[model samples]
Target: MPEFDDLRDEPFEPEVLSSEIAFAGAVWDVRDDRVRYGDGEIRRQYVAHTGAVAILALDADGRVLLIQQYRHPIRHRDWELPAGLLDVAGEEPVEAARRELAEEADLVAAHWEPLVSSWTTPGGNDEAIHVFLATGISTAPAAHAREDEEADIRVEWVPLDAAVRAVLDGRMRNGILSIGVLAAAQRLRDRG
Candidate 1:
């Protein structure tokens, strides 16, 4: 075996010969691009997104807040963190997390710490998610009106350990939820 340097993702921007919006959807757009590689040109199409934020709201009892919403693409009401797109122009990521927590869970958090960030699906989309560990939790003063899929969201608070188990047991499959729960669990262990 040979020793190696630090393993990390490097930024490489190949020359784009041509780029176009193949489809324009209500929330996101699909982009088709022709890029010049080292020896040849390659064409790729992916979803161009505005990114998003998620919150892992932990209460004093060591439980994490989760929401169940219907995902048309997956055709399942998956359990997930309180999350929302960064579609609001000029809104900061943490602020988006705060707003999402209130809108989805009807909760507000006083203390927040950045837990982790991840690219949802690098091979097919440019959507990145920033997850925060929100503590000092309380009910929001005003409730937000829901619509469509969000109108019937099921909110639950489960123990942090139980959430980790669900992720490991293949019960909870949301990408953001898995990342946030694992990161928060590790952070808590490291703190103790």
Candidate 2:
């Protein structure tokens, strides 16, 4: 007999009854899963989410621009690159990137590189995130931020080697940043 985690012999099938926004400011959904793992079993699941986007702003000094913000879920300040949601209606991805760069870091760039695209968490809701590299940057002014954000916005000019090391050391937790850094390095190496 194969070991099964089902201690309770509950016999049931999953059926999505109704997915309704019991509250505001969230994507609410109810889903059902009919398991066919050598047997007929089912389960119901509910999920809700708010999607977002992330932008990687690269400068001429071979350093990546990042933002230090307090993430409520983690309950600590995280050093992540500038990012925002594709929340604007009828806005292109590039436009969303530019807006996020200006809004979060007050920086602008002359060159835009199509780096990569990702779904933050595809297993649940439809939350997709787009990543880009903005090179040849210059200083500007931040237009938007939360009113109560305990933010100390400092732009760290980290070299590629240092960035990779940060990832190894567990300092850089943002997956997009690591991906961006590796891509930038490859781009540089290819130029040689």
Candidate 3:
């Protein structure tokens, strides 16, 4: 009998028979791969992502920073945490989170601690996102220029509990936002 005391994801890599790009986009690409599995072979396709980072910026008053941006796929301008892709070569995830916080919210944080890491859609994509808890926040020295959907981003600060409520009520639908807020809230409870 195997012990069931600990539950965690185990990494496994199967033998790849063939792999190729099924679709190439500006940011991500769809990868088609044939792998040997259980005495047989299977073909699968998924988005090959560069990964991303999200920051849950919390102020002294317990308010969380959020930004509303237009997401074309969903066709809704949904509220989301400060997040961006890890597209820059040689840049660390924490640095990417810091840059995103500054760029999206025009803010800087004195303290940053990792909250959680998740795979957005393990079945459809290989996108892994790292969420960080940012406290001791202040305005950035300079604001970054925005373009496209980010040009009209709306920034707001909501109480941490209220943000969690929004997530539970389905008013907030961004996966990263939902995960970050809930994880931050749980972290607070654990600390208290």
Encode model 2's per-residue lDDT on 1-192: one tens digit a residue: 887776753555445334454445443444444444434444434345445566777666777776677777789777777877767778888888888788777777788877777666556555667778788887765555644563456657677677867876888887667776777677778889
**Candidate 3 segments exceeding 4 Å error:** 1-5
Model 1: lDDT of residue 129: 94
In candidate 2 the C-alpha lDDT for residue 24 amounts to 51
In model 1, which runs have C-alpha deviations exceeding 4 angstroms?
1-6
Can you write out model 3's per-residue Cα lDDT over 86-161, one digit (the tens) per residue? 9999999999999999999899999999999999999999999999999999999998999999999999999999
- Each prediction's total of clashing residue pairs, residues at least 3 apart in sequence or on different chains, is 0, 0, 0
Give me the runs in candidate 2 sitting further than 4 Å from their true place. Answer: 1-23, 26-51, 141-146
Indicate whether candidate 1 or candidate 2 has the larger lDDT: 1
